[model samples]
Target: MTLNSGCRAEGKTILVTGASAGIGYFVAEQLAAEGADVALGCRDAAKADLAIQAIRVRVPAARLRSVRLDLADLSSLPATVDALDVERLDAVVLNAGILLSGPERRVNAQGHELMFATNHLGHFALVAHLAPMLAAAAHSRVITVGSFAARSELLDLDDLQSARDYRPKRTYGRSKLAQMLFGFELDRRLRARGADTASIIAHPGGALDSLTPSRPPLFVRTTAQRLRGLPAGVVLHGKHAGAQSIVRAILDTESTGGQLWGPRVFGLRGRPRRETPHAHMTDLEAADRLWAASVALTGVDPLVRPATPLRK
Candidate 1:
């Protein structure tokens, strides 16, 4: 299950968004244990501090810092990048997302559907802004955390905002599909431009909180909850196991651009493995259309030219 045990990232710096809890938290913990300088990108300053403290409990020598990143507010992405202030980034894990549970559709500050905007547009913008930092590294990676849920959903590029028919779960799946399309398209553009950065997609199979190990303030599962979720846990898995795909994508030297990685057992549970993405996910035309729409909406074209060097 722990594929990266032999991998050492001593001199590398990686950023993980939504590290405050769940799969992101576990991914950061594993990376820190591998000696990577980890930047926890979170929306809440307080939660970020708690996650750092919790991670340090497990990794006393972890090199950890926090970046205030609110994906819902696209206007703040530039400032978030400025706050990072790192000369080069070894990798970035686009793991943060909003999983809407309510039937009612929500919208972010930009007036876009909440799930689509936060899960897709926000990450698209964030990566574009961080393109230079990624480019600065001799070799870098962008790990897009997608979902098995997206396998059954179709991305309506026309209704990206989900204005006409917005069911909660469907909207969330479509949003993730959009994000995956962007990740694949990004790799295509990077290769075309001869950039050194690689983009890979990773999806946590089926992660449940109750099956996840406790980290005190950040995440704690009640004994009753554990018992209740035991059946599903046996079949599915926890966030800890779920995070392995992302970790492998970042640390696995064999990993290449445009590859899809996920759990080994039917793409549902087990260790990390590279698998063929669903046919729909590989549609180049659909990916290209999503790319153009994303550029129009975010106003940032990544890898278009050499990035300005960051101040040390």
Candidate 2:
């Protein structure tokens, strides 16, 4: 769905991570078309440049910039925030991510498992670092892209890094679950702090598709994907339809501060719809535990106590 010229993002400054390709690229372009000053974040400088060029070509007057951001590396986040001047962000979309197909475990520079680090921890640190800026924007929002797979997975804090038993698919599911939990917890914290910022979550359903398949072996992956069916986007599903929901969440002033929006059909592919939080995911004890663990793992805290709490 196309955003009307009267869309609220006009004149807003927004940053979208992983804007080099796929849904991220389209989101950046759409935002630009709506008159948002956009910053496209990608791990590769060349890819980011190409995305920026493409957006400008699509909208000659598009206000867009490019920056380097490798979500696997926490150290790279500071530079990325500096490049975009986080203080000016009206919204920050965490869209960049990776999916693994095999059982081979990978570790990021920070020693966190690859899927968890990139999908959850990296974005965790990015938001934490930019929390002050988000707070400064008054009604600013932090939108995180999560997946419906989260509902099927259970949070195992003991194995959060996937150090004990490792399965690529399960690891990815856990990471997405962590993201959803974080979004919920962040909203609560923001409210407690009396900040106007909102924390929102979205999923692409299953619309992702490409003519060019992965290089390794198309047949194997294709078969696996086909067997996975709707969830994997092998068939028509709500992925892109969910994108519209994300757009709505970002622009709709009536939306509640913490909500999960996705496709309404089969929970996979369909138009965006408001979803009830998974009962397992809403536990305050779990949220608190995950928040504490994340703070220790990422070494970034959204809530930092001052030297003293001033008396009322």
Candidate 3:
């Protein structure tokens, strides 16, 4: 509850999941400072409160709210949507995800691979649940945060879930690939339906906490990370820098549905600009397969199910 006094986003409302920390937090904070009413979607109440408090400190009159969204639990997502008081959402940034701590593959309660579950499937369900709000808005955008790994040669559709074969880097990259596939297909579907919303993609180049001026305690510095601190300054950009692409993807007036924006310089460190996604991510057949798999697994369809009328 605050006044958006002279910012471009004065009357807009946006939902940023995984906004409790890291790049998500940076994006949410920036949006709030710019006068957008931001719904910080997070599972941890403490972190959420901290994030809100931090933004208020900066913006002084920032409008902010919270919604509990745990990507690991599909059951909690729809309820999360129901709790949002906003009648329409101008943007929804699907930014929350996990880089698994170990090489051993883990699974969520629904049994999807941990990275894929949290990053792709969870976001898949969330976007579907929020579609109504998006439709209600005069214009809306759905921006997904992707990674450089999405361009790697690690994607293997034969074992998309990585049940039989799992490599940490490859699995993470594939999940990003899945996200892009969904994003592209989503734009195609939304356009076919003549929807006013746009589905856009953006990725932070090589952003890490180490490069941040504030250097918040987001992660413990490994010995190797410490050794490269000097090089990190040149190679790594801060979270704030990373957030530029997300902000542009969400608010850039010139952008269109299915367009992608990323770092200008080889994806390591630079300003945000429109860029093409990898060939693997642009595959329509793969997008269709991933979309079907996501629907079957999450039990939430982004298409027909969202428009179905509720019954008492």
Task: Candidate 1: give the clashing pairs.
Answer: none
Better of 1 and 3 by lDDT: 1
All models: lDDT?
Answer: 0.88, 0.75, 0.82
What is candidate 3's TM-score against the reference?
A: 0.90
Name the lDDT value of residue 178 in candidate 2.
Answer: 87
Best by lDDT: 1
lDDT of 3 by residue, 1-312 (tens): 122233268789999999988899989988886778999999998888888887877788999999998988877776889888777999999999888758788988877788998899899988888888888887799998888878875456678889998888788888988888888889999999999989999898888766654422333456565556657767667778889888877776777889888877887777888897777777888888788878878877776555542211
**Total clashes in model 3, counting residue pairs 3 or more apart in sequence or in different chains:** 0
lDDT of 2 by residue, 1-312 (tens): 654345567768888888887668767877887778888888988878777777776688999988888889887777777777656578888888898997799998878899998988888888876766776775888888887678899989778988989999989999988888888888899889888889998777665543212222111136555455545454445223445667766776656678988767765666667888788766788888999988788777766622221111
Number of the candidate with higher lDDT, 1 or 2: 1
Per-residue lDDT value at 284 in model 1: 97
| Candidate 2 error regions (>4 Å) | 2-6, 210-241, 305-312
Among residues 3 or more apart in sequence or in different chains, the pairs in candidate 3 whose N, CA or C atoms overlap within 3 Å are: none
Predicted candidate 1 versus true structure: per-residue lDDT over 1-312, tens digit per residue: 455455678999999999998899999999998889999999999999999999999999999999999998888888898899998999999999988899888888767799888898889888888888998997799999999889999888788888999899999999999988888888988899888999999999998887888998788889998898899966799999999999999998889999999999888888899999888887899988888887666666665531433111
